[model samples]
Target: MDRAALPGGVLTGLWQRARLVERRIETPTAVTLVLAPAEWPGHLAGQHADIRLTADDGYTAVRSYSMSAPVRDGLVEFTIQRVHDGEVSMYLCDDLPIGADVELRGPIGGWFVWRETETRPVLLVAGGSGIVPLQAMIRQRRAANSDVPFRVLYSVRTPEDVIYGDELADSADGVETTILYTRTAPAGSGRPPGRITQADLKTHGWTPGFDASCFICGPTGFVETAAKALVAMGHDSHRIKTERFG
Candidate 1:
């Protein structure tokens, strides 16, 4: 077997023992855990990791969660949402205590990452908890003081359901954010609450011919719909990349 042909995780296994140093409640169902890996090779914005949890009886549950920000002072953070029936998610979000140990591997997928060198205008679309990795891009851009003009279209159930709400709000000056509430809207939002539509993308996103790079992360349906819409609006199909979840 060719070593070069080996899968990334197999070649550079991220498997390591890590300690949970901090935790933040991002939302009712989501929590961000800051882990200090004994050995971290570092990671890019939009990368994710595989977390494996073991029970006292030796049963194990494995799940992948996105890195919520660029590596900060040798610490990597994951913002995980509780999936009631998902054993791994449930433990990470609810049962796991600060200072506990867990097995982890990654900075996983490579194709979904964003680089700081690209100067073209960017358009980021996220839905629900899919905002985790995308938020890393926003943070990296700000940290580098890169003048890469970008905008975010975040769709959520309601204002209260928005994670990193205040941070996004405060950083709105450089990168614009348009929140579409599917279930309800806050008072005086003017327009009735709705899902993100073609009109919203056109008005708030880059025009099809603007040479903007589009990154959309969300449920499979949303990604397909948004990708198709971008192509239909004259954007180059190759320039639109997506990361989809259930």
Candidate 2:
């Protein structure tokens, strides 16, 4: 039997009615939803799923959200930032109740994924909610017992705005993690409070000699700026992979 065709519920309906099984508060303004498949289907880390919701009037809104859980897990998670006017986000954050059925189709997109075969040193740059996919990569790498050196530079408006702060800190036990807070002052040693600049990368040990593979995710402006900087630093443009959100 094809794994894809297994009784995972109607692909279209499982794509539609996978309810919000759990929710957790990340930051004051952010929430993470754990969606369980009416029937389980595995997903790959670093991939995203499309979530759709129907209105009482039969209208629907759709949005793509990156999965935060490790691929092997039966449950899928999405860390969402509430956007005032965003239809899906607003629904997920406010109106969607625990156990309320929701629609999703996913384990989608392969371009941004990291697999065991990728042996090069990695450098991840993310801003705001863009850290979602990088979180998956971090978990997958750790699970595979991979020794590949990797680093992440996460930029946020303030310390409070940093998503997965505790998880990222714990994950940094061996891997490098740098947090740049643009709106707040640096709390103590090693924390840089400002927007990401070329100098910030240098201070974080991003050297031209590293020959690293770069993965950048964020808003259009953030991705463009980070990619250009990495390219100017002599990193091969072909080795840089980017996923821009909005």
Instruction: Give the residue spans of candidate 2 off by over 4 A.
Output: 1-16, 171-173, 189-192
**135-201 per-residue lDDT for model 2 (tens digits):** 8888888888898888899899877888888878875545788888877845573655677888767
> Model 1, range 37-149, lDDT digits (tens) per residue?
89888888887887787889999776777888889999999888777687677777777888899987876777777899998899999988878889999998988888898
The top-ranked prediction according to TM-score is 1
User: Which residue pairs does candidate 1 place in steric collision?
Assistant: none
Clashes of each: 0, 3
Scored against the true structure, residue 117 in model 1 reaches a CA lDDT of 98
lDDT of 1 at 6: 12
Model 1: ten consecutive residues of lowest lDDT = 1-10
